[model samples]
Target: MLTPWRLFLCQMALNIFYHIAKEIGEMESKWRLLHKANIKLCSQLIFTFITWQMSGYLTTKNSSLCLGGQDIFATVRENSPTGEIIAHLSINGDPGASSIRLCLTGENADWFYLEGRTIRLNSSFSRTLDREVLGSVLIAALTCYEDDIIRSRYRIMVEILNENDNMPYYLEDTIQPRYISELLTVNSMVFTVKARDGDGDTITYMTDKSTADASYFRIDLPNSGMVILDKPLDYETKTQLQVVIFAVETTTKEKYSTTATVTVNVLDGDDQYPQFQPCAPVYEDGDHNICTNPVYSVNITETDEDAVLYFSPGPIHAEDGDKDILTPLVYSILSGDGNGRFTIDSKTGEISLRQRVENRLLTPSFRLRIMAAQVNDPKKYSVATALVHVVSENRFPPFFNKTVYKGFLIESSSPATLVTTYGNQVLVVQAIDRDFRDGINPKIHYTMQPLTGSNKLYHISQDGIVIAKTDRLRAFDRHILEVIATDEESGETAHASVDIEVLQRGQPVPRSPFGEERLFGDMNAGMAGGIAALVLLVAVTVLFLFLWLAKRRRERRDPADRGAVALGKHPNVEASSPIAPRHVL
Candidate 1:
């Protein structure tokens, strides 16, 4: 703190320099002819002002002068028995209030005393200022400076707060429907309803309808707000049910109840067995063995509350009501075959024959009882009775003997005698009856004739003739005769015929050809010549090979021969030049 008293001394020195520079300025303008002298005087005044402005260092060093917002205690000494008066500003430094200016009012307050004022200590200077008679003073600028010096010891603190500003709801609203069987046990996880919140905060769960098992449902973990079913579900008794859920926030405990209907549809399980209604009986019509048509109208039906199941029947389950447990009404067989050839529709309960019956040995009418089994339950069967009636139709056609015999003649050559050829002709009949021969008759009849050039005439004896009728016939001739048998009821008949051709008994006669003949008979001469030419070519090839071999041997033996000489010289010339000379010398 620079004392006001010291500041007074510095103010007086500053005023003196101020007045001297003002005087130098006034004198320099007045003495223009003494320009060099005026210039040096101006320079001296400028240097003096700069030195005085920087003179604070020589007075108080580097200590700060505290001024505002501080508390301090100051004291002043008037009479100094110890040779000089020292105005010591001693501050009771409160760490909280380091320094502050306090206007200390007192008597004789003519001087505002600044602290740390250095006055020259001398006997005469100390004589007027008293030391022991010191008085209290105010710490003005000095108090503030001390406050800054103590500020680093204390620290400041602050804080913020929380608020409830979030909302509670499921992030996803829609959910899928779940299906389960009514037969499921309790505590089974049929489905889990999940929900979420945008705030990532804790969430809660509730139920819209609390009347039925609502307490079992609740959100499980953190954000997994899911509804769990605590009981079993059944579809047969209860087809479908809705589970309404309400979501809430765990933190704020605020809830917005949204009824997301979790549909629990119960599915059908294997519950109902099949059952069947009764069917009608089957019958037969016409001759028993020839009956080829089935007759019946017996249908099988079934029903169940859970599900209408299938129906089935076995071979014993005939179309005839005699075999059925329940006979059909108003549906009767018009014409039926007695064979085991009938069936009934299990699902539609429509009774009809399996196929058009076709078998011999089967009865014309059937006294059968059709038995039908339930589609869902094959063990349960029912049966009914049928009365079969057989009607007689056309009898089977009559059959004749398969073999037919023709008469033979024993005659000599020219003017032959009439032989008994008719006696060799046997008209035999063996007829069969499909109706087991119900009093039917079969007979044989015959007539005879002799061929032309015959000598004697003969006649049938009326007991199946053995003689020929030469007067009405020619000798050595050909003829055909037939005998027929028929069923008396159907008029269906069968016949057998004899074909007679009288043959002369001797060696056969030879005949001559019509056109021309050659040496090779019917063979073509040009074709034969071509074959001879091929043979000649093969002979010539063999001969040429033999001659070539013979000539080659002769040339090898005769080395001096002309051909051998030519062969040797030809190779020499060819070896010398590949091109052969046009004319050899």
Candidate 2:
């Protein structure tokens, strides 16, 4: 293979020299001009021509200037600083090769400079030599000069070796933040990020291992740059997530890399069951909390029947776990229905008793497991425990101290301030339950029932303190609310009226024995009662005197008047009326 390649190269060189000799022969006059100016160069050329004729080829081309090829190849790494020596030049045919004079010229000539026998990079054109921009090879003409004339010329092909200089960049529109439903299956592709390396190195993708959301994702195929979900997504625990991806050049010793942020917008999916409110939240991710529903409870008397029950810690309410997707929910008494005695409203979640509890001595309490399920998807459901305590029948119902309560609220007060009455004292709406010794029944619950459609302006705490958001109320705004006190255990309730008036800022409350001055007018009732009694006495005396005068006048006018005015034992009167003998004057 070597011998045949050499013969072919020799033949190609012979044809190239033949064409050069024919051209030189035609430029005889120019050669003479050069011979006259520089005899040494002409004489050398003549000897070279004679030798070419004798050997039948220009073997001089193969000396050191030519090695059966026209190009002088060299290699240098890209990004090499200026003055970096990449190649050493030589003129092997000439004894003083190390000291030979050489010149560079071509498209890439400025990229290099000659120093003695060494060639170095000259990067005055850019900040640094870039393989991506300069391409694989840099080309230039390297010529050996003798006597200030070009003796031989060759092409310099500097191979630009690659380096891990550039960071990988994501291609346009290759990756973007995504909003995905939490119901997305595990191991599903969430993102496909593509990047390119200028050096054409193999790229490997990696997720940030130290982040919390990293465990939720995995890069199964390192080279594919596909991001997959490693676990289930729960919108209840986390609504949003961030992932950091790294595009790395693995084969490079320096391991160049670039990073970008990916946001996983977890949308709500109808995949979770309804949860009882006043949620019992647990920290699922240290940074975010996940909530679980709580149990419900209420009490009913042994004789309770056909009565609706209100459970506490809030009502028997369950909200869909997916907050954004509030699908309709229905309630049912899954267990402890009390043998068809207990019934539940499918829509309102109200538990009612259809039959009376026969005996409290036998059954003290009923454990009711109530289930709330989404109407669209019944399988997605949750059960809450309802404890119903069955106690003896209530002998007496609760009653408020006053049939009507008058509460005063300052318009300048904040939402958290309690309602006050005259003299700036806290106004309490209290109830008395004769059944309880202290008249304070633990089972009695108070609520401020709205008289109108809106009740958000005021709130009544369990202790019967009315709090109004005075910021939402104007001065002199009067609100009438019906307050109800119900026995939570006996299901007996009492109602009372509350007149809440909004007072202007800095307006003084009237001093009165009764709470509010307007509700109970300011008047001395004791003095007024005494004056009324004295007037009644005077009227009685005056009426008696007038009656006596009338009787005397009538008796003097007529005997009949005397008889009519006389008592049964009248004194001896005139005998004109002997028939009325008993008449007394």
Candidate 3:
């Protein structure tokens, strides 16, 4: 502290100089020449003012008059009320109150005034004490004096204490939308934001959790002003993120805070390879997803050549997985076509055969590796399999042995009872395809073609077995079922009829209208002599009976011939003998 007694002296001396300068106007005024002789008086007054000094430094010469102390200090916050006392003026000598006076003066004197012994801010001044403009400390002088002579003087320092008056603010451009790539490395700095405190307080940064996208980012440090990515980014899920940042000051008595909203735009990165359409996802982890290309298949006959092949699932297609930018893709066959037997269109993934299949019996199926790659970048590509099955040409159409077949089933029997023919024999319907040995073709299929709507009472198996649902079949119910025989590869069909009669429970199945003959060709060479051998046996039995009859007739005719000879004398006897002989033969 600077003692007010000494500070007052310096302040008083400074005030005298200030008042003298204000009252003395310009010495060389226009009218001053009219009283040129008075210049001497003005010079004397100037001399007296120049020689004026306080007893402040009289200690070297032992002059007794002096102030108590020249070291005085005080503090007042910025924007302090006018008339707020900053320092008290004091004097050491025992001068009467009526003889001594005090005042504030110096370079910054106008900012304050004196009320007897106290120095305070002057509210009448147009400017106020703003810490932003006045800096840390304000300086002035205080002086005290006797009626005519300077007594003591001292310098006064009033520290301008800082106040939390300004709010923090962010630069206009720094908080605008920023573009970030989804392919950015983890734990890397995304962008930076900084806030300024006008009051010059140390500022720290923090993200507000109340915002929805706060979890995706974090502050690098309390005071770093650097925003970092807290987790990986996904463009597909979130294209933009908003973060609310708060810049605050806690060093002052009251907290000061400011907020800025930052938008981070996620840009699409060409980080994914081309993927085939109809994606089959196999694994998923948040935005990281994986899938496999499906294997496409199609069957063609060995005779087909130079034709565009169509696939089962769909035509071969692929696209860039980055949806925002659908980059064009090119297609080609990578392998399994070394002989150039197949060619593919690059833009449109179409496969065409070059020539006929020489030998499908040796190589039935071909697996070609098809690659789809981005046109701009060849390294980014995906490979899939195209399966082509070459089959033999179909020749013969299937046919049924009988146009219509009759079979009977007893009602009230267990479910899935088989129909029976004459003599309780199980009836079987068969179709013949001469292309195969034994007139049997595995490729041939059978189905019951409904003659009427809703045929739920019975069902047919793939192998042409007609089973009757006994529980559903009422007693004495008759059903006529139309069956179809199809040659699957040849696409030819043959139709036949199956007349099934549902007999009452405990009733026998009547004989077939076609007699004991077998309906199908399967009955050949079974438990019977062949037709040719039976004919030979019948002929031999007839010849033996004829020979025995001839022998009996000759024996009876010999007795008859002798009786006729004895009656040879009559003519009627001779004629009767010829007739008798003929009858006997």
Candidate 4:
């Protein structure tokens, strides 16, 4: 290879010689020397032109030399399978030398070896498209510009491109759906996902084979989201389910997925049987069976899921001749309207017997039918029946009060008292009933009243106590008080009377005698006492005046009294009259 300065020096020398030769061109020797220098100049120009053409040709080639479309471009793979590379080059073409030298010029371009080289083509050698080259290798090919003259050239081209071999995957590696239903609707978009391929064309859309009815779910072609809903759901038959969906590539058929599920719960409505929780009191060994006593009472209850619900039953009829339904019947009760033998509560669907049986009469069997009807409809109803067994027991009612007391006492304060008072002492009425506190239906009420002929002075308490309202008492008052106690459940009542006496602790004093004695005593003693008091006051005043006068006369006789008195007349002067001779006289 020739340096730029060497080539310049050679050209300068040639120019000087050619000018000299032209001056002497008439001689053959000078003409031949000029011709040789010109040829040498032509060869250098041609070599430079060939180098310029090779660079342009390689830069714009169709990636490779070919006749029928086979083009193999060099490629570089880095962090990714496809990346970018840059190249730089320097070339020296020696016109006089036999070969050209080629070398890469930059850090990245060092991978290519372009040392001394030459381009040679045989008569039959043609450009082939599929020739493979090892990396950045710089090859020089010769092109002749003129007859018998040749120049070596250097060429390089960079090829950066893409690949398509990556598998399809969820953009986030996981996905979620708004909801999953036992019966999903068609075309509902479930998720949005994406993936990448190194080969640039490896991915496509497909279904997840693991999912139920895999064909039922599909992925969108462009955006890679899913659409689902293969069938209808029946909550009654099937309440819940699970499903899996996937994103897949069309070419490689590779897939990744996330799973989701839906829950469908069947609600309980007003369809259950109106069960008659346990009814009737459990029998005890100590209870005695009685005719008018209550056998049992049942409270009814029902359930529903609807916001509002109601219950109804057929018309209620008495099992016995009496109108009391709270009392038990002697046999199994049947509803007249429905297909059942048990008696159902018209308000609440509770069933119970109408009567209690004696231990000897107790039977081991009783059959009854119960039904539940809708409150809104008369015909809409459901029926259930039950068989009951009665065991021997002693359930019975308390006895009535028969021992009556004497006539009731008469006094004030009796109407509202819970207990009656005799001489300010309250009296209690002892009574008894055998029914259990809870078993007593409707409650018992007692009422008391004085005999009709008795004076208006007597009254009875609201609780049936008879007492005297007036303070006036009399012997043998003999007031008749009536006691009536009625059972609220059986409507049976009993009546009795009590004799009462109104007596005081002391005997009564005569009103006239007492008034006269008090009046005479006050009049006689008060008059005598007033006269005696006046006489004593006059005596005291006369005694005080007499004693005062006596003390004055005694003081006049004392000469000491005159010495102490100062005289209007002087001691040395004589009085005009005898009685005035001296102050003492």
**Top candidate when judged by TM-score against the true structure:** 3
lDDT of 3 by residue, 1-585 (tens): 334454454445545655665577754343334234453454454445444543334552354334664656889888887999987655554433566666677877787887755678875456778888878888888776666566677888888888778888887877889999999877789888877887988888999988888889998798888898998887877899999999888687667888899999999888778888778789998766789998887777878888998885788889898888889999999999749988999999999988778788888888999999999999999999999888776667789999988888887758778777778887778799888879887877888866754287767777777777888877656788898887755657889998887776666666757564432222345434476588889999999999999998877766556566656553344453446755755
CA lDDT, candidate 3, residue 238? 83
Q: Cα RMSD to native, each candidate? A: 38.5, 18.6, 25.2, 27.6
Query: Which ten-residue region of model 3 has the weakest summed lDDT?
Result: 518-527
Best by lDDT: 2
Please, what are the lDDT tens digits per residue for candidate 1 over residues 1-585? Answer: 344544455455545755676677865443444333444455455556656767864453344333112222333333323323323333333323425332322342223333332212223443343221322222122222343343211111111112233454444534577676666666545555555554445665656656453543344442454455565553434567777766666665455334466666776654322222232224334211121122232221111112211222222223221221233322222223234244334444344444432332364334545444444444444444443322334545655445454554433343433333333334323444455565234322333333333334433332433344433443345555554554433345666554444433431211212221222423466877997899999999999999999998876764445654675664234345555655444
Q: CA shift at 266, candidate 4, in angstroms?
A: 14
lDDT of 2: 0.78
How large an RMSD does model 1 have?
Answer: 38.5
lDDT (C-alpha) at residue 181 in model 1? 66
Which is the winner by TM-score between candidate 3 and candidate 4?
3
- Evaluate candidate 3 by giving its C-alpha RMSD to the native, one decimal: 25.2
Q: What's the residue-level lDDT of 370 in candidate 3?
A: 98
Error of 2 at 382 (Å): 5.0
Q: What lDDT is reached at residue 249 by model 2? A: 93
